[model samples]
Target: MPNARSVVVFDAFGTLFDVHSAVARNAASIGPASVHLSEIWRAKQLEYTWTLSLMGRYEPFWRLTERALDQALARSPEVDPVVRDTLLTSYRALDAYPEVPGTLARLKARGARTAILSNGDEAMLADAVASAGIGGAFDAVLSVDRVRVFKTDPRTYALVEQEFGCGREDVLFVSSNRWDVAGAVAFGFEAAWVNRAGVPDEYADLAAAMVVGTLDAIR
Candidate 1:
């Protein structure tokens, strides 16, 4: 959004990484019901974060993700501990979107410092980055675990400033999540909504400076 060079801070889950693949990775165990399980698990996982944020009773994303899986699995005909464990282990590495690798490379070629601000635990993020083969592409990976809270919170945004030594205007925050984009905009960062699904921005008034269909439009 900023014409001048700026730091790029990305949201990890739905933005940089493909969360749906988290369950899909366990397809061998989940079988034909994988899509339903993924949808339930992902939805509840986010809902739990918001619930925790509102209640001020924060749990690590890993625990919350597992809880979401449990809730989704409870509706199934039978439960397999091995299957659940396999799904939980799958979280350690999920696939990145198709365009992500090249997008980051281009952002770096033009001299922008990049970092990932995620709800994921450190090990979760580490494994994801490593699995994606893009660990070297990031300047840093920040986690809400430090503050023990979830995102769309001002404190989560502040972690970027605290770690990167930059001001809101000098940073371009990007996320596929409208709430996250709104939170960064509310915190004064120039933001771009990577509207991957082509969904309308509910907070159009608060608004990202640019709303692109993919990260390819970022530069």
Candidate 2:
């Protein structure tokens, strides 16, 4: 069970925010390829992070996001160049999940320290948070940019302890991404896998403390 002193850290993209909404918003311009484009863009974005990490190289997540978009667009040449610009702009202000504000409010009401720990760069996180109008909901919005690396990295997870001065056990790390939950579990933090899509599970050896279909089910 969580307590007032427990820090409830959340993954921003896909967890609290809807990363695919950018493409959804531009569906009229993207035609039948919108879903595929969004899927490829996200997969490549994550791939770049892991690949760059292993190569001991670093780039801002925003750059990787744009590059991923380029690849997605390359496979979708039917989309106008103007639409690509619009999609990129839309991504910076992706919509928050409907339950996010309420869930964060409920957690804060109980005196839990809430925060967003994301692989996004600081500016990207800032734009998304502000656009969602949930800027005041978090005690902090931590970005992997500080360490110049991405998730599944020990240093990336260490930001939580460094910010809250709490032990791993006292933190409940929540992410919609199963791999991220696995990484948190491996780092010794109690984690919740927000399996929002009801997808099949992986990383069976790194089980989450809890698995829920939505953020509201966390408590």
Candidate 3:
């Protein structure tokens, strides 16, 4: 396996940015009691992604986000329409995780190239990077729009290798999602699970090369 010298391709949502905050903001629009709605919605969204991935029926992340949000709202009658729309707007501008800047800086200082490989469309990612004031933090920002499939698919994972012009083993795939870490490992990339929630044992069978509480740990 290639070491840290290899390019690091990170998953955007949950790994580098906070998608939950956006969901919460939107859920609040419907009703005052929707505090935990965003979290539940996020979990369901990820579950849907995994389910679709296994079923071989792939859809764009944006579509999934909208679908997940709609379903989540359907279950809760108090969500307001105006608030929901505003929350959707907030999603396009999610703040970066607190550790993202320092961790990314450390990697860059070490001469390690960094990039984002996400299910987010290029437009959404561009806005997010700009909003987070870290557009330059990444060497490349990859998207799944070209392939129309989510992560774990060979086409989506292959972008890292293609962009950096490196072999699969020469890239270190980092993600907060266990399925993503597993997929990277399966694809021959040195995988690291950013166990931000301390869920190392949850994905233990995937054999992630490394597990860390923060990106700084890996850097």
Candidate 4:
């Protein structure tokens, strides 16, 4: 029997998939530049999203990601046209964290419905999920595209309640991103923080229900 709160909603990207996998996978071409590229690329990508959102300028996450990549590798001597294409291609098939499939399966066996509420566009989510071989694991994959907004938007978080027809408290919203955890909690969901990097809780005031290091510790 499932608990009263039987729905688990995950934040995709860095939570389930390693956002740096593409760079690491193409390391031969990218060289030692992968480390700096990953950090700057991720930061710039997120900054672009928020910047666009604040300006009411809407663009697909894919577009923002490509632009961020251009900026990240713009001055790097290591990246060539071919390496750039390879890194972009690798992004389509990101590596899933080792425990993701098992954790999802365990939740499913317990009669819980699992889903992904991601800032990723539908196409990106589909490609990554399919590549990770965890496509069938989710009952639904909710992309911000449907609402046409990024996370931290109340509308994005509302998708979970909308899909499950349950109150916020009945959906255990899990995210590895601190901002995302705070956003879900602020939106009234029973949010949990997957502090996988062992960082201190920056949003401790958000009152998250759980502050564990991984999805497997969601309870």
User: Number of clashing residue pairs in every model?
Assistant: 0, 0, 4, 0
Which is the leading candidate under TM-score?
2
Per-residue C-alpha lDDT of model 1 across residues 1-219, encoded as one tens digit per residue = 449447998999989888888677777766788888788888899999999899999999989999998998887655454588777766777879989999999999999999999899898888889999999999989999999889888899999999989887789888998989998999989888998889866986678888999889877
Error of 1 at 125 (Å): 0.8
CA lDDT of 107 in candidate 3? Answer: 86
TM-score of candidate 2 on Cα atoms, chains taken together: 0.97
lDDT value, residue 97 of candidate 2: 89
Query: Which residue runs does candidate 2 get wrong by more than 4 Å?
Result: 1-5
Candidate 4 similarity to native, TM-score: 0.94
lDDT of 4 by residue, 107-163 (tens): 888898899999999999999999999999999999998888788989999998888
Residue 10, candidate 2: C-alpha displacement in angstroms? 0.3
lDDT digits (tens) for residues 91-172 of candidate 2: 9999998898899889988889988999999999999999999999999999999998899999999999999888988899
Q: Which runs in model 1 stand beyond 4 Å of their true positions?
A: 1-5, 78-82
* Local lDDT at 181 for model 1: 91
How do the candidates rank by lDDT, highest first?
A: 2, 1, 4, 3
Superposition error at 126 for model 2 (Å): 0.7
**Pairs in steric clash, model 2:** none
